[model samples]
Target: MNKWLTIVLCIGLPLAVGGVSAYVTVQNIQNWYPGLAKPFFNPPNTVFGPVWTALYILMGVSFYLLLREPSSEKKKQAILLFFIQLVLNFWWSILFFRFHWIGIAFIDIVLLWLFIILMIRQFYRVSGKAANLQWPYLAWVSFANVLNAAIWYLNH
Candidate 1:
C-alpha cells in the first residue's frame, strides 16, 4: 500500500470510529439514566468533543508512527494491539451511552486501559516515537477509567 494511504488509514480509521462513538454518546446522554447523575467533576458536555477528538488524533498518530517501522512480527503485534484498544474504546462509549450500562462500561474501560498498556509496550519495542504518541491517549483513558468507575459507583 502507498505510504500516504497507510498514514491516512492509520489516522482516519480511528477518527471515524471515534466520531461514531461521540455521536452516539451525544445522542443518548440525556436518555441514559446514570449519566445524568454524574459528579460535579464531570466536565461540561462541551469538553468531551474536543478532548476525544484530540485523543483520537493522538491515537491515529501513534498508529501512524508504528506503521513507519520496517515490517516485523513485533510491529505486527503492536498494530494488532492498537486496533484492539481502539475497538475497546468504541465499545465502552456504546455500553455507557447507548445501552446505559455504566458497570459494563467501567469493565470495558479497564480492559481498554490494560490493552493500551500492552500496546504501549509493543509500540516501544517497535518505535519509541509511537510509544510516546500514545502517552496522552493513555493518560486520558486512565482519567476516563476513573470517571467511569466513579459514575458506576455513584449511580449504582
Candidate 2:
C-alpha cells in the first residue's frame, strides 16, 4: 500500500469506528431508561457530540503520526496496542448505551483508560510527537472515566 494511503487508513479507520460508536451512543441516550437519574455534574446532552468529535479526530492524528515511523518490532507492538484500545473504545459505547450496563461500562472504560496509557507510552517510544498528540485523548478519556463512574454511582 502507498505510504500516504496507510496514513489515511490509520486515521480514517479509527475515525469511522468512533463515528459508529458516537451514533450508537446518541441513539441509546435518546432511549435511556426513564427512571435512571443522572449526576449533578452531568453536562447537558448537547455537549457529547462536539466533544467526542474532537477527541476522535485527535485520536486519528495521534495514530497517523505513529504510522509515519519506520517499521520495527516496537512499532508493531504499538500499532497492536492502538487497535486494541480502539476496539475497547467502541465497546465502551456499546456496553453503556446498547447494553445499558452501567457497571460493566465503568469496568470497560477503566480498562480502556489503562490501555490508552499503555498506547501513549508505546507511541512515545516510537514518536514523541505522536505520543504528545495523544495527550488530549488521554485527558478526555480520564474525564469520561470520571463521568462513567458518576453515572454508574448515581444511577444505581
Model 1 score (lDDT): 0.86
> In model 2, how large is the Cα lDDT of residue 133?
84
Best by TM-score: 1
User: Stretches of candidate 1 above 4 Å error?
Assistant: 33-35
* Model 2 residue 60 CA deviation in Å: 1.2
Best prediction by lDDT: 1
What stretches of model 2 exceed 4 Å from their correct place?
1-4, 33-35
What C-alpha lDDT do the candidate models reach, one value each? 0.86, 0.85
Tell me which residue pairs clash in candidate 1.
none
lDDT of 2 at 44: 80
lDDT of 2 at 27: 65
1-156, model 1: which lDDT tens digit per residue?
A: 898888888789888998888787776875664336677788777777788888888888888888888999999999899889989999998998888888999999999999999999999999999899888888988989888888888878
Q: Which digits, one per residue and each the tens of the lDDT, describe model 2 over residues 30-136?
A: 87844568777777878777887787777888888887889998899999999999999999989988899989999999999999999999998899998898888
lDDT of 2 at 4: 80
